[model samples]
Target chain A: EPEVTQTPSHQVTQMGQEVILRCVPISNHLYFYWYRQILGQKVEFLVSFYNNEISEKSEIFDDQFSVERPDGSNFTLKIRSTKLEDSAMYFCASSKDSNQPQHFGDGTRLSIL
Target chain B: AQRVTQPEKLLSVFKGAPVELKCNYSYSGSPELFWYVQYSRQRLQLLLRHISRESIKGFTADLNKGETSFHLKKPFAQEEDSAMYYCAVLGPGTYKYIFGTGTRLKVLA
Candidate 1:
């Protein structure tokens, strides 16, 4: 099975610094999404992208957060200023289409210091 | 508000015993339900979906529209079944999935 792969399984960034989380979604998938799970909390949806633009986003995806499909295969999530509350396991997922089940990546564990 | 709820934070069952992980949702419209499992440090893998109505790894979940529940059940549990399971719902007008807090199942040998 083609799986979504994320880079830097663990990331430690200083507060107020910019950090980018990278993900390579399934080659043939069309819809991409970003979700985060804070320790002991339910997984929260961040943003969903399709046709090279954002289709939907949650309140947690504020102005400080942005997502881009810089290329055909790379879907990146950038945080302009890291906050302590931003520490969590960030997961990237992709599906063939809106109706298909999304396949999730291993997740990047972001830790803010 | 649309939400998925897994009341039990943790459930333990001995090998060969039956297992049931409860899930309930609060969605007015017809919703798509799914069960995803994460083992140890692995990524979330789709165990089953309500639409397919297929059994995967001896696990099955029925969508009870009247009860607003989609509880996962397995006739016989195995040690390998121990993992974190999450119930998610996607409503008619949304592409984002609302996930439950997740239940940690520990199947003792």
Candidate 2:
């Protein structure tokens, strides 16, 4: 079965530096989403993308955060400036449609110093 | 407020014993409920969906509208069933999912 793959399974970045988390969703999936789980916290939704535009986003997805489907298969989340609070396990997911069960990637563990 | 709640942070069950993971939610609209499992380092896998009403891996969950709960249950547990389970709810017209804190299931042999 096709699965969403994320790059740099683990990332360590210095504070105030820009970091982009990359994900290649399932080939035929149409909807993409980004979620983060801080240590000891539940997974929190960041944003959802479809049709080359953001369909919805949470308050956590502020000006500092941006998402782009740079290509047909790649969906990337960029954090303009890393903060200590940004350290978390970032998961990328995709689904065939809006109401379908989402398939998630292994996740990228981002550690901001 | 739209939220998903899993009161138990951890649950333990002996092999061949019955298992139940509780999940409760508060949503204004018609919500979609799903049970996702993560085995060790593996990614989250869709275990069951209330809408499907089908059993997967011997597990089943029935969504109760009046109680506002969707609890995952397995008639018999196995060692392989040890994993972290998360309950999530998606509200109508909302593309984002509200996830619960997650319950870590430890099936002892």
Candidate 3:
């Protein structure tokens, strides 16, 4: 079965540095999303992208966060400045449409030092 | 606001025993509910959706609008059913999903 794939399974970055997490969603999927989970917390939604634009975002997805679909297959999330609290497991998901079940990637573990 | 609640953090049952994972939601509008599971070292994957009304891996869940709950159930559990399960809901007109804290089910042999 086709699945969503994320790059840089794990990343370590300086507190003030920028980090970009990349994902390649299922080829035919039309809606993409980013979610994060603090070590012991529930998965939290960050943002959703469709048609090259953001459909919705949460308060957790503030000014420092940005998402881009630079190419047909790549969906990337960039954090302008990483904070200690920014360390978490980031997951990328996609669905054929809004009502469809979303498929998730293995997730990228981001660590801020 | 849309919210999903999975009351149990951990549940353990012997193999061949019946299993049920509880889930509840708070949403004003119509909600689309789903159950996602993650086995050790594996990615989170969809187990079942309320709309599909289909059983997978001998598990099934029914969307109870009156109770605002969508609990997953299995007639007989197997050791391989051990995993973390999450209940999620998507409110109408939004792409964002609200996920529950999750329940870790361990089917002991």
- Model 2, which residues run further than 4 Å from truth? none
Q: Which order, best to worst by lDDT?
A: 1, 2, 3
**Considering only chain A, what is the TM-score of each predicted structure?**
0.99, 0.99, 0.99
Instruction: Compose the digit string of candidate 1's lDDT tens values, residues B1-109.
Output: 7889999999999999999999999998899999999999999999999999999999999999999999999999999999999999988767798999999999999
Model 3 local distance difference test score: 0.96
Q: For model 1, how big is the CA root-mean-square deviation?
A: 0.5
Worst 10 residues of 1 chain A by lDDT: A94-103
lDDT of 1: 0.97
DockQ values of all predictions? 0.93, 0.94, 0.92
> Per-residue alpha-carbon lDDT of model 3 for A3-96, expressed as tens digits?
9999999999999999999999999999999999999899999999999999999999999999999999999999999999999999999999
Residue A25 CA error for candidate 3 (Å)? 0.8
The global C-alpha lDDT for each of the candidates, from Candidate 1 onward, is: 0.97, 0.96, 0.96
Docking level for model 1: high
Candidate 3 docking DockQ: 0.92
